[model samples]
Target chain A: MVLEATNNVLRLDANFVDYTLVAIYFVFVIGIGLLARRQVSTSLDFFLSGRSLPAWVTGLAFISANLGAVEIMGMSANGAQIGMATMHYYWIGAIPAMLFLGVVMMPFYYGSKVRSVPEFMRRRFGTGAHLVNALSFALAQLLIAGVNLYLLATIVNVLLGWPLWVSLIAAAAVVVTYTALGGLSAAIYNEVLQFFVIVAALLPLTLVGLHRVGGIDGLVDKVNNGPVENMLSSWPGQNLTGFESPAASVIGIVLGLGFVLSFGYWTTNFVEVQRAMASNSMSAARRAPIIGSFPKMFIPFIIIIPGIIASVLAPEILALNEGKGDGNIQYNDALLILIRDLLPNGMLGVAIAGLMAAFMAGMAANISAFNTVFSYDLWQQYVKKDRPDGYYTRVGRIATIAATIIAIFTALLASGYSNLMDYLQTLFGFFNAPLFATFILGMFWKRMTATAGWAGLASGTIAAIGVAVLSQDALGPLSVGAIDLKGQGASFVAAGAAFFVDIVVSVIVTMFTQPRVESELKGLVYSLTPKEDRTDPNEKNLPWYQRPVLLAGISLVMVIILNIVFH
Target chain B: MADTDKQAAKEKRAIRAFDIRTIIGALLGIYGVILVLMGIFASDSDLKGGDGSSTNLFTGIVLLVVSAFFLTWVRLRPLLVPEGDDDAADAHIE
Candidate 1:
């Protein structure tokens, strides 16, 4: 295979047809956004799609919104480096948390009628807790949006030889225009479209790559013969060092990713939950995440397998340099290299369209969540109260534009980071770890006081920052030990530590403080809410296979089988 | 009797045939069909890029089938207007 090298920079041989196909994708996405404009008459419609979307639409969009450029590029990079252990992000990290959101938390969110996740915090805890959580969430969304934009621009610049600035500006303009006009309905609809585009784009690449490398067995043999060994194993030991970090033991993966980070993101992060909240009914809302879990189980085959194939096909490009300068193969370019080397012109255009769609869907998801939190949680609540529905709707539109502009600058700043996924998860550790602790204490325990809630949130966040600082070797005086805990392992350790600290602080404070009255606690806490209110009214009417429990059970069984086979 | 009339009007307004699913299904089917055609008629040069294979053609078929399934699902169980405004109340919470 001949790889095009121009000035030592590898570029995909994209022609006029490829560029035309990509342009068509942009027009189609923006058109969908404008088409949905008719549906956005009220603030509720703008932010939550009038709460009328079905389970399938919401479910697909739920997973699609999370499948950003970072996920496609970053996970494949991990797959190349660590092999099958990358599946943990899907199976252990994502599936359980998604199920918990559907089965346990959706009732409180949908039943109580909170517009956003921070509002849930306010209703459960008090203003101080709400503001802290809301501000952190809003900031995190912007940063994450910036990261997505940065990754997309970098990949485009490398593949198409377009200037990074042009890519960033064009992407921002398309996403902001559609998002501002269409609202959440437009975002969700486009996400479903983007989901199909991504799958269509990547599945072909995987098939072609596998065929070139030989079939599944050929892939296995090629990968084993390459520099990396045990590329097919899911377990930590046995030559598979779990996500390229020695510190990422089985326990660390379980607690950090599976419990704290995953639960924090899937359950409380407004970006994902906003999709479920837009469902037509409480039953649909509960089922949305559950339905999403079905596709979430099999996504690794398309995404991760390409990276593994690249490890064997282009080891020179996949190689890393210890120095801070240029490496033999930039790890993040795994997906791009596969496309450049493998796909034909017509098919290449389709893959590029899929890549762009994934980037736009991710940016739109973050921007949508940012606008909702800013308008409802921050602006309407504090900046101006009791505004007309149209007023908040206007604010949401303005917020989308503002957030996009801010994200552009943030993306520019994010160019300094070497690994996109590591930067993202570390940020998640800073906010999500402590945030999940607060949510857990408030949800299951009725006696948990507002004072305790704020304390746990504040202290838990502080603990995470402290652990991160101490884990750094450069900060010698601040370093706790010589152990250099990095990657997901460091984030997991910080989150696990914060989880316990938040629990301890919350428990002690709740014991000393007065609990809210029964009336105040109704529908908010598990113990106080009636059993009938908690149960889905349509559960008994549906067939056995259609129920959330059975769906979750089947998904878990499949995950278990994959783990066993891969292990 | 006036309340009943008002309720009837609201229900009538809510009973529209078009929904998000219809839009998703139709758009995906259109795009998938176009892609499949392009893949099948790809030039010799294009075929060289993919090693004389039809990966795009197969993937496009899969997308087309999935899109049809979504459309069929909507036809089987169409959305109806709920009797009361539970969502409206939830949406307005301070």
Candidate 2:
């Protein structure tokens, strides 16, 4: 029964036209890769687009690189489980941090001329902090890359009615081909392409889903009348945060998710930052995240709302949610169920292609980031110090292939969870939360020593892992259940704990150690950097709306309005 | 100086030939045409999801419009790879 229902949802009754559309999309994806390969003459070109892409290109790639497995599958799963509360992941969790990245952090990153995020750590701190960051970041990318690969494989399993292993290899091969051939240029260009394909596919699905459910007001009624209550509105979101009181839940989400997890992921993570760094000019780099935030604001309407629609609209999902349906149908299958039910041939093919694009975009991001760090940070800084530029580019290509293969194995690990978001957030809490803490303190406080940097990062990560383990069932069977926290709230609390511990350790360690010389800290430390160094020179020439500051201000206002309306 | 000028010319040509806007326009245009064809020749069963409304037709037309806009934007205000070497871009790093 479970197998049959899973099959029913997985295999859309797609005809020849649908297959042709998907085939065309695939051809375009590979063609873009081949085209990008022609331009890859140096290591910089392969890894960083030679820092020569325009603002709009990088901006779209910045968001599209993120729209992969996490946004479409994980967030949609969150929407299916929690309803309106999922809006917070965008309004509360992403927009402000994105603006902060554009306004405050991009200057430091682009200005430093660092090859990668961990490389920035090397400049600000030292080798100790750099090694720790590089290793952990590489691991995180592999783990997350596996999640995207596994989901892509899962879709293939259903679509072709093939086994999981075959599908996994097939999906991994596609991402590997483009990234290995063209490197970051391939990934970025294809990402820009995938972005449009994704919107084209998902937007239609959302509109059709809303139509099926009689629009937003109608969805609200169905939800209220259905098995769930208070889903149409976003407020405390008790179920989402796993906190008992409304106030506590709100506090947890704001502090943990909004401030720590969100900023940590958006600002510090190289996957998104690499896109900004690829910009030809500092002004363009500054504008990247700000531009991304506009579309980022409304993405939840299409991605998350469709999940909500599926939850109430699809009988299979409703049954699965109620614990009476097929065993294989979980909240993660929410978007798939909607696609299978609502879309007909030509659009169905496009949706399948979109899903494929999303998964590849996500996995490609992780792979590209992984290879860059592996070659530039881990290899160049430590292992192979004086290799030719061409050698490092070769190393990068080899690393891409290596990461993709390892991700195939990691994909197996990702299959253990039913809802992928919880696991993803847990990993973010461990890596990003502590990293953000160290970054914020070191950037603002000149007194933060190199000793504190590594020490704080190491201890904070341990603290987060410890917290997640202690929380009952949050990490699955290994959890001690010593803490009362459960659900996504545990990750939030873990991130908060990680942030606090890192800050405390950094400060305590800083008091004893000798601070870096002020002379050396210029441009690396905020107060020491010149006013002119941080601001773009050409920015004044642009119109009011084109400027980063004004664009960010407008974005902040729009997000606030969205939050209130949803509440 | 002559070599730099030659290099800059080659770079500008690369930018124009492989402009992202052109790729996006071409892909979207192709998909749009295919989708429009599907919409026109759609069977009765295809309209079931849209409650007899041709969703394919509507989406296809919308995509075509967006595709046209992208292509026109490329023609009117093409992406400019700033002339001269990117040494100035790096000079800002300090």
Candidate 3:
């Protein structure tokens, strides 16, 4: 903790009033939380904001869901470690995934009025499938929450010189408390405030970092001449044959992550899914992600550019220690280093505050969504049965506290990892890929049975765990090199295999399992269509235009473009 | 008989237009699936280099073109509502 590091660590002209400006900025966020408390009442109101938010709110909330310290820290670290290829995560990965989800997948959730994604799956598939998806989601979020808190701590430790644990505890406590008190409404409102502050504070820092580094051209020249820059330019493969080729490295980034990872994230993750569920209408839900996607276009420039610049600024420290040493790259430390050694005093505090906002936005979103799923899908749907509005609100608060505790424990455990970004991404793959496969299969394919969903989930989990364990042993012959197997990719492969297996098995089993009763089938399909249309005798003769088909088309076009471009 | 004949004519016209959006949407969705698949495999290749920057630029251009077409096409097509389709409950397109 370097809080007491020289006060004039990085001298730049600033007014004495900057401190006041920073304080006022925090107060504004707190004010949003307070004002939002009026919106939470019933369990639905608490969890989903009574399913009536405007597109902008949902849009801001969607971006805030991603505006975690892990993403910010990881993006910068990636830039420092991998060069410009890091931008592919957003350009080729996230944006298209988001648009696809908004247009193609959201209608089912909003149309059938599902409180949680797992519940929607259960309704369409079966309870066993629902449980697997639910548990996996909880596990994934636990890892995500942990990594997010760790990054927040690092930022605080780097800038404010505060103890990692102290910062972690403070961030966790504030986010948990506010989320518990106001539910999704408070989180969304607070997120809007954080979004503005982060952009205002960090955007300027990125510009200055580039300017000081003598712009992109200067940075590029510096990198070309530096020994450390060579490592950053090319990815090293453990196999050491053709595996280490720079072209292969780029392709891996474009395909492995840009498309597969992006689709899995936006389409299935609870936080992103919940944003659409919060919108007032299907149209609004669709609009939310489109609007949210716009911010992502600028994010790589704001976050990653600084890291690339940092590499040039501190090539000596950024050096990779191979063989005899820990091989520490300290890519994650670049942002804090920049703030402490680059930005002036008052602005340092403002930037730290912006980092704080990023952490809180992520924490608040997770807590709010976790509480919603637990209280609505798990609690009211099962435990309480019939409680008053006030009672549900109180219970929702308790659930929020419980979720916060789980997240804190997760964060504490996750803090031990040296590379926060790698851990976060890898850990997400462990569960996310499987969950996504099941959800996509369950949603689109009517023939997918519950048996298949459960089997896929169990098998995927086992496969991921197996690979993770074996990869650790010397005899296992694991050769990913810098990449960890127990991390996201192994899980993703296992999950994907299970999903494909389930589709085949479920189809086979369904033949023996008896088709869903005509009554059940009718309820499922007809509920998704307008009642009057269903009742019409000449429905086939009516216009064949379908909204899902239209949306799905746009999603298809975008995905194709991303693949082609990134490929 | 005249009224029935008139109604049938309108339905025929609506169905023709309806085919446009559904066909286009379906085509776009197929493309999206392909792209996702390609992203998975392509990520392990050379699509991410300074020299590879051309690949990204080209892909982006294709996407912009396709998206522009789909967006414009969808707007041009009207919702193909069935006659007496008043049950708002079925509006869900998922």
Name the best candidate (by TM-score).
Answer: 2
TM agreement with the true structure for every prediction: 0.91, 0.95, 0.72
Residue A36 of candidate 1: its Cα lDDT? 79
List, residue by residue over A1-567, the lDDT tens digit for candidate 3: 112223323232333333444455455555555555654534565777656666766877798788887688777776765565566667667877777777656666665667778777667666777766666666666566766766666555545556767877877777776777668877876676567557645665676667677886887787777544343332322111123456654554444455555676778777877876777656667667776776765677778778777776754335642222233335666566565455543344456667787887887777776766666566666678666555767877987787777877776666554344354445456556556566666555555556666666666555544444454321133424334433333433344443455455555665666444444433234333454422324423534332333443554565466445533
> Model 1 clash pairs?
A317-A329
Segments in model 3 whose C-alpha atoms lie over 4 Å from true places: A1-19, A228-255, A321-329, A416-428, A467-499, A518-567, B1-94
Worst 10 residues of 2 chain A by lDDT: A1-10
DockQ each: 0.35, 0.36, 0.02
Worst 10 residues of 3 chain A by lDDT: A234-243
Q: How far is candidate 1 from the true structure (C-alpha RMSD, Å)?
A: 3.9
Quote the positional error of residue A253 for candidate 3 in Å.
4.6
TM-score of 1: 0.91
lDDT value for model 1: 0.79
Q: Of the pair 1 and 2, which is ahead by lDDT?
A: 2
lDDT (C-alpha, whole model) for all candidates: 0.79, 0.83, 0.58
Clash pairs, candidate 2, are none
